[model samples]
Target: MFPSKSDFLLRLTTCLLSWVSALILVLIVWFLFVESELVWREVGVLRFLTDDRWSPSGDFSSAQFGLFPMIVASLLLAVGSILLAAPIGVGAALFAAYYAPRGVRQIFPRIVELLGGIPSVVYGLWGLVVLVPLISAYHPPGTSLLAGIVVVAIMILPTVALLTLSTFQQLPTSLIHSAAALGIAPTGIVRSVILPASRSGIMTAVLLAVTRAVGETMAVLMVCGNVIQAPSSPFSPVRTLTANIALEMAYAMQSHRSALFATGLALMLVVTLLVLIAEQQRGKAGHV
Candidate 1:
């Protein structure tokens, strides 16, 4: 049978859009790599990856561009946020998917979606004003790794919840019916069947949330104290690569600018790895 004209147009349009998006991503990666080559040559890969110092001013001979601290901070921020948010988000998703009244379900997901839509800067301001002060009362200097973790956890909550909720809701009706026929309780079904079936989706959701946490800038910057040291504890101040780039790009010059670009490239690689993991999980979920 011949395809309809509208169907043909729709496929062509979608294909073109996908290609365009891929082209844009390629261009961005290419630009970052090209611009950062100087720093790679100047600093060498081993020192760039392993050195803890980040001083980039004064003579080039004295300057350092090691990103180890920022790398550690970024990892802590993402991992901590995921640890804090994933359980809460997953619990909320379960309630929304199976326990909430219809009206409550509708309203709750909408509220979550709204949270996702809110600007990052607004979240930053709120963290700075409310969360920081509250933490500072108990912790002294509230703008620390813990603060960034909390802020980024909140920032990624909606995403994790919504994705997890969707995954739960998409479970096969037949599986639930079979479990019910076998006299499985609701809690037992969720524990043994639904959750196991949706494991890949849950992993994808968490990975995606981690990616967002790692890439977040303004909110983390506002709460993370912007210090260059490697964090030894959750209460210690630290800086992430994203925060580092945003903090100094405006005044950076020469090799300093290239070093920033190199930081950006490193960040891109991390995010790309996370996205690839998420895609792999999604592929597994589809097969299941």
Candidate 2:
């Protein structure tokens, strides 16, 4: 009877931990919404989103908190970075998983994993030193949308590569063998068998990588010219929503503070959706 009670207690503890996690997520949503109410009340929802001018001149009360430009900037940067990183990262992942010499493959992935473990600050510092000089030579003032995208691409490459590599590793050997048995070339086998089998995983990785790029602050801040205005081109100075919040939150007053919280709330919403989508894809893949 004592053993039975002990087992029951353990099961109850595990169930409680799961409920606790769900409760914490609920609390976080409530906190952000509660804090953002001031902004919604003051600006009205439509104006807060559609208004473009963000500067407050004489009166802090009249300051604009339009997030459209910031949202566009963040989306553009995230998309550009994914475009730049995905091909290279995914290619490297495939090579490592399928084609590379055993010794080199083993060592290279470890190095990439080590890169991922490095602090964001270190990446930021490297970007400031290397990217700033490189961009300034071509573009006059250095900080630009391109620089931020490039820096973010580099930062998220390890994540994308590692995830893709895992996907490739999980693919069944029988598919590859069957392709080879049909006299298909190595490239054909990869294109026909491995890629199709791994499509869901690759999509999941891309979503996760994009989410990481979108939310990244320190490295992006170091490289992205934190201009409030929208970019005229990839070479033009631009600001991201995360960078803007970090830059202004300290000096922001009442409603301004609340507006920043609203931005945070918006970011959280986007991230949550991406995570859900990824989970759904994973579930479908598991069913397949």
lDDT of each residue in 1-288, candidate 1, tens digit only: 427998888888999999998899999999999998887887777877776588876656788768888888999899999999999999999999889999998899999999999999988899889988898899878899998999899999998999999998888888889999999999998899888899999999999999999899999989889988888888888999999999999999888888899889888998999999999998885323
For model 2, give the 10-residue run with minimal summed lDDT: 55-64
Which residue pairs clash in candidate 1? none
At residue 258, what lDDT does model 1 achieve? 88
RMSD of model 1 against the true structure: 3.0
Cα lDDT for residue 279, candidate 2: 72
CA lDDT, candidate 2, residue 33:
89
Q: What is the TM-score of each candidate against the true structure?
A: 0.91, 0.93
Model 1 lDDT vs. the true structure?
0.89
Candidate 1 is scored at a TM of: 0.91
What lDDT tens digits, residue by residue, belong to model 2 across residues 26-117? 99889888988887786766875767687632343667767788888999999999999999999989889888899989897898999888
